[model samples]
Every structure is written in structure tokens, then in C-alpha cells.
Target: MNSSVEKCHMFHESAVDLLTSIDFCESTLKTSIFFVAFNPIFWNIISRLEYYTHFLTKLTRNPRTGCYVLAVTIFSLGLVRNYFFEQALYKQGVTGVLQNEVAKVLGVALIIIGQVLVLTSMYQLGIIGTYCGDYFGILMKERVSAFPFNICENPMYRGSTLSFLGISLLQGKSAGLLITFFVHMVYEIALKFEEPFTMKIYRNPKKD
Candidate 1:
């Protein structure tokens, strides 16, 4: 009876430790996710502000050059966001049994599909179109209704969300799953601001 009690005590302690570790990991993951979600929103707001103010153009002395600089800045921020996201994944504990061989395969497939949509959209848009050049008066001749775009209104955002979900599933990280939902929420909010502004730009040629 004493031995059984001792064994039960040990198991309880182990479970407590496991829970503590998971809590720590989740805290770190939330911080990482905040940065990932914030970066795009920050840049989008700043870029739109720049467009309205012409501060970037004044600083650069050329609208095209200013747009290019903003594009580079946005791209760099994206890289940083990805780094934080990866770090969060690393910190997360793999507690789910569903992260088996099948999960890994599904994750890889999702990543591939997401990349295809992203790359194809980029190709269709070119560097300027991909990076909000339209806001800077570098507008596309017309809307692109190609493979990815036709399939989804916002392929880039959807693809990115899918990639995040895929990675979370691949690693079987609960923290990652939560982060993915946060990512989707942030993108949805951004689109609410973005789509209307973009449509306004196109509708009023005077803005361009």
C-alpha cells in the first residue's frame, strides 16, 4: 500500500511539472504571436499614412523611390514576424498525439499549397502590386482573376493562414493552434480596412 502511494505521488508530481512547462511555453507563444500579428497591421497603417501625408515622398524626393523603400521595410518586417513565429513553435511543447506521420504529411501538403497561392499571386501582381504600390499610385491596369485569386478573394492572406495552421498541426502544438487563430483574426481585421481603401483608390482615378 505504501509503494502504491509513493507511485501515485510521483505520477502526480510529473503531471504537475508537465502542466507547468506547458504554461510557460504558452506564455512565450502568445508574445511571439502578438508580434507576428502586430507587424502587418503596423506597416499597413504606416504605409497608408505615408500615402496620405506624402512624408515618405518628401523624404525620398520621389514617389516611386518612397514606395520601394516602404516595400523593403514591409518585407523585412515580414521576415522578422516569421522568425518570431518560428521561435514560438520551437518553444511549444508537442503534447498532442495527433502529430503523427500523417499530420506531418498533411502539414507539408498545406505548406506547398499555400506557397503556390502566394507565389502565383506575387507573380501576377509583380513587386509593386504585391507590396501596396497601388496606394502609391502604382496601380495595376485591372483586377487579376487568375487561378489563386479566382479560387479565393484574398489568396495571400488565406495561404498564409493555412501555412500557419499546417505548421501548428505538423508540430502538434496547442500554442501554435492558438497563434494560428490569432493570425487569422489579425488578417481579417486588416482586410476590412484594406479592401475598401483599395476599391476607393481604383474607383476614383483622381486619387491615383
Candidate 2:
């Protein structure tokens, strides 16, 4: 127990040190972080609002169409966030520890694995499932429990977080790493809200 406590404490201190190395005040970095924080928050709020009000469904005149609209908006936002993250990486200082050839190789491997997980998840879920189609009253026939889902719960979120870390390492940027950490944190918080709400959605007797 003492050893576990010590390890946790050490990890916390190391994280603090890593964060201190980043330039939080830089415009690009701040913008990227804002989007990183904003994307999940925006999606969650919109999804829940749709659940409660069905305003999007009413606007589109169809559930699937509403989900598709949200999916396109989310996808476009992601592209913009990625662009800012790349721009921030260019402006940030490189960490010496991540400059080695081994880091580059590991980074490539991580990116490949992350993409596989993400792509496989998307393929399994489809666009509706990938986004918040269930919130639009369009749920899966049953719970998905294949391949990536069997191997990893919330595979898309996990895969995205891994990809962020992989890119940070590839770039050797402290700011990228810091932003990746924030991305992971935001996902975790989003999940806290998402999981229970998703369960509630599926609890309706109409589901297959």
C-alpha cells in the first residue's frame, strides 16, 4: 500500500513537472487547448440537449438526418482542432528526451496502432453510432461487443488519446504533450457524463 501511494505521488509530481515545461500563454497552444476542451463539451451539451428536446430532430425533420448533421459538424470541428494542434507544436519547444530515433520509431508504431483502433471502431459503429445517433432516438439493434469493443471499452476515445500522445512524441513538443494530457482529461470527464446518460437512453423498452 505504501509503495503504491509512493508511486502515485511520484507520478503526480512528474506530471506537474511536465506541465510546467509547457508554454500555456502561447496563442497557438491556447487556441489548441481551447478546442481540445471545447469539442467534447460542445458535443456533450448538444447531444444531451437533443435528448431532452429533440430540437435537432425537429429542425432536420428526421432523426438520422439530424445525427448526420451533427456528425459533419463534429468532424469539421475536429479537423480545425487538429490544425491548431499542429500549429502549436511548430511554435513549442522540443523536449530533449523525445528527440531520439527510438522515440520516433515508437511514435510511428503508436500512431499506427491508434489509427487501427480508431478506424476499426468507426467501421463497427458506423457514422450514427460513432456520433450520438442514439440521442436522436436512433440506437443500435443491440450493444456492440465485437473486436475493438471486446478488446477495449470506449475504443474511439482511447484511440484518439493515444494518437495525440503519439503525435506529441513524434514532434518532441512539450506543449503537444501537455495538450494531449488535457485532451485525455477532457475525455475522462466527458465519459463520466456520457456513460450514465447512454445507459439511461438504452433503458427504454423500445430498444432491441
Candidate 3:
């Protein structure tokens, strides 16, 4: 259908426009993007190191305590990254098209859906499962296939991407959208390393 084709074309054009309109040189935006890329890399490297060396466990003298410490560190960094993102959004210019009432409603819906997916996944996994306790030789007895996981694989990453996009729309910031796209790209790369390695860990768990 011509109408359907036009809609698809328009959607692509709008995304391109939003991306192109971003101020890439903004310091705050750069910082936010850096953090976006950094978090996953940091965690993956640290988790893998922990898996091989048990440094955190040795340091804490308890597997659970080590995991909790890593979780706290990750959580704190996430908060800092979010704070920087908020600050960057303030510094960036707004997109006129995303300032409309429809955009606001859509943003609200995406945020709600994103939060539901994120929170529910966390609940299903618990703190140990939510974080990389598996790398610490602490893993769930079985796979989790419920709620958000049942609906989608990698719900946390998807939900996080949705949240970033939602907030970008809510703020009408084209820079936010650009940063969010990179956030997603980084996550996808992280997953490439993560999923296979995690599977290997589970398939041939460490022997005591």
C-alpha cells in the first residue's frame, strides 16, 4: 500500500532527522555517552575477572557478600550515569516535533511499559540473578522464563533502551535519542560477549 510505504519512509526520515540534529560536541552529551558505553564494558570485564579469579569473593570472604558489593557498585554507577544523562538532556536542544501532546502520551506509555519490564525482570531474577552472580559461581538452579522473560529475551536491556527513548521523547531532546541509540549499540555488543560466555559458565559450571 502507498500509505503504508509512506508511513515507513516518514518514520525512517524522522529518526534520521532526530539523529542528525543532535549536538555531538556538547561536553555533557559526550560525558553521558561515555558513561553509556562504559557501564556494560566495566561490568562484563569485572564479572569475567571475578569468575576467573574470585577476587571479590576472596576480598569479602563470602560469595554472597562479594556479589552484593558488586551489585552496590553497579547500582551506584547507574545512578551517577542517570544523573549525568539528566544533566546532558538539560544542556541539549529540544526537538520541536517531539514536544507535542501525542509525543508526551507516547513517552509516558513507553516509560510505564519499560518500568514494568525492568522491575518485573528484576523481581523474577532477584538481586543475585539480576546482577552477575553466575560469574561469581552463584547461579540460579533453573532458567527463568516468566513474565517479561516469557515475553522477550533480554528484557532488562530492551526495557532499558525503552526507558532511554521514553525519557528522550519526554524531554524532546534529539541529543537524548542519539545517545540512546549508542546506549543500545553498546548493550548489543556487550550481549554478544555476555550470552555465549554465560552459557558456557552454566553448561560447565565450576567444580569445587
Q: Highest TM-score, which number?
A: 3
Cα deviation of 93, candidate 1, in Å: 0.7
* Ranking according to lDDT, highest score first: 3, 2, 1
Residue-wise lDDT of candidate 1 within 21-119, one digit each (tens)? 354535557677777777778878877877688778889898788888988988898887788778887876775444479978888888888888888
Q: 26-50 in candidate 2: lDDT tens per residue?
A: 8999999999999999999999888
List clash counts for every candidate, in order: 0, 0, 0
Task: Give the range where candidate 1 is weakest over 10 consecutive residues by summed lDDT.
Answer: 17-26
Question: What is each predicted model's overall lDDT from 0 to 1?
Answer: 0.79, 0.89, 0.90
Q: How close is candidate 2 to the true structure, as a TM-score?
A: 0.88
Number of backbone clashes in candidate 2: 0
Instruction: Note the residue pairs that clash in candidate 3.
Output: none
Per-residue lDDT over 66-122 for candidate 3, one digit per residue giving the tens place of the 0 to 100 score: 999999999998998899899999988777668789877888888899899999999
Q: Candidates 1 and 3: which is better by TM-score?
A: 3
Off by over 4 Å in 2: 1-21, 205-208
Better of 1 and 2 by lDDT: 2
TM for every model, in the order presented, reads 0.84, 0.88, 0.91
User: How high is the lDDT of residue 91 in model 1?
Assistant: 74
